[model samples]
Target: MIPIDLQILKYIFMEKPIYYFKMKPYFQTSEYHDLCMYITNRSDTQNSDRLDKRDYTVFDLETTGFLPEIGHEILSIGAVRMNGNSEKLDEMHQLIKPIRPVPNHILSLTNLSRDALNQAPSFLEGFQRFLTFSENSTLVAHPAHFDVRFLRAMVKRWKLPEYSPPCIDSQQMAKYALPDVSHRLDPLLHYFNIHSLERHHALNDANMTADLFSELLLIMKKEHNITTYSVLQQLLNRQKS
Candidate 1:
């Protein structure tokens, strides 16, 4: 029998200041570059001149807290499928049960009660479903680096071998799109004239981010002349250098 507790603990880490401090800078290292390149290149998405002609899977994760290495756990996952024109095709949202009781603060922040999560899918089950939700599309997320880390942690915790690329990050593109403004999701949504479905809800937030990403894609293509996923990755990689 798989010790679920031990598998859960694999996602949590002993708080190590050294690793935490140097994590962001690590993205600039050649080692990180090579790893990301290897995984992303293995994907079969075809290159296209029109940025809007490629489909993407925009997703989001709501966690118990910020630190993935500690006790922070993914509480829910929300995803939306977009067509070649960036139109929403379908969606999936799963509330996940954590191994422990959720704190009051998290409950208040996410408005997800213990009773609610208790009825939801377990971590392993929910995560496997999320992989299926992704299909063969490029994963899109706001501040993708943080979410992707938690995702990779999920695979690690479950002892599953999964290759994850640094997904197409809307925040990075936003920084390039609206360089002199706030890149926070809520404010950006307002800037783009997008109405918020709800705040702090994983599914709603994913929907909002998906809309925001579509808007940013237009900006990236027109302003920076980036028109495909390949170019977008190359462009961001250059910024990392």
Candidate 2:
């Protein structure tokens, strides 16, 4: 027979498992229908001919889990509007209440509380406000795959309007521009000598990403002559291949 304390430990672990982070993807058959079409059908009018002349909305999200299909939800969004590589036009930050309670680890990581989130607006209201702030600017985010995927998941779940902005992944941009260095935000921040923001805060991260992307834009223009959205896409694709 097991010791009493060991038995209790086993029962606790078995009854209430803690997911420190999600590793497995939660696949959905509808993802292709719900998410892929948005990418496929992005409006050509939204793509700016010149990178240096374009307007962009650089954004970030704090979420409860990695995969949205498994009930993971967005906790907050942070974004900034920029004109080309030089001018920052505006900023936006919003907290969204999830259907489930915020986990202890997430609360610690984000400096957010269940009480605060409980008082916040639902994802629909907050995201709608963000869309208004974003307008029709090109969407920019570090690791666009994660943030955009989460946003698309929410859009699908909420039956919101199709998100049609041309999206750019700043992380991929960094990887293409500086193929030698680490592309994670912290190392890139250090590499570019950009000042660090409070990590895990959505707005701060967005601001940092915007700054990093601006630097990258200048580099791409001067070194690679990547002047247009089409050229930028081609460069990124070549890097992937």
Candidate 3:
């Protein structure tokens, strides 16, 4: 056998053991330090933390355009954490400098100016901060596919290692919970009688989505008796199929 020191050196040089996830973000807070890794194995269905007791990161993005593929880019990110509506946790909002100027319609919608973005972080850094804020929580969004698509697009654009997490789409859940009405955020908020919340702003949008998610969780629990993320994932998977 090789000598112990040499063996260790060989492993270190060639095939280092994975003590922490390689793709983990450059972390921000102590709360997120140990939890920066991507979600690899999902939780158990029956024995894990029930859906109402767990944490979720609801996020939104403002972009220069709709499609990330055709030179569209993210301009801002906003996120908030929720735990069964027990308490409102800290939220994260970041502006990212983009390659393109903000469009007139987009500027009118988001109220963000090019001047503001001049002082903001790069896309990679902003995304890293958002991920750090997310910690190990499940992700949620109004229409999750849009936000997730942006994220995946950024990962590819920046040449960063991949990072995709389990996400709950509040819009789709609203469709399931109240099938008769449109699943758009503003309409759902109106249907649920959630009032006074602003729209278009990223942070406001994220919080609004979280509120909708909380309402839907109650409906899901009562109607389907669903109580865990695993079960929710299974249900969502079936819907996709």
> Of the candidates shown, which would achieve the greatest lDDT relative to the real structure?
2
Weakest ten-residue segment in model 1 by summed lDDT: 14-23
> Model 3, which residues run further than 4 Å from truth?
1-49
TM-score of predicted model 2?
0.80
**Model 2: worst 10 consecutive residues (lDDT sum):** 18-27
Would you give me the overall lDDT of model 2? 0.80
Q: Which stretches of candidate 1 lie over 4 Å from their true place?
A: 1-50
RMSD to the hidden true structure, all candidates: 9.7, 8.1, 12.4
lDDT (Cα, tens digit) per residue for candidate 1, span 101-198: 67788899898888889999766568657766675677888888878888887555433456565378888888878988798887898899998797
Q: On a 0 to 100 scale, what is the lDDT of residue 216 in model 2?
A: 95
Whole-model lDDT per candidate: 0.74, 0.80, 0.74
Pitting candidate 1 against candidate 3, the one with the higher lDDT is 1
Q: Give each model's clash number.
A: 1, 0, 0
lDDT of 2 by residue, 58-170 (tens): 99999987867555689999999998866999999999987666779999999998988999986756875786677667889999989998898777655545665678889
Sort the predicted structures by TM-score, highest score first.
2, 1, 3
Q: What is the lDDT of residue 192 in candidate 1?
A: 92
The residue ranges of model 2 lying beyond 4 angstroms of the native Cα positions read: 1-47
Error of 3 at 230 (Å): 1.3
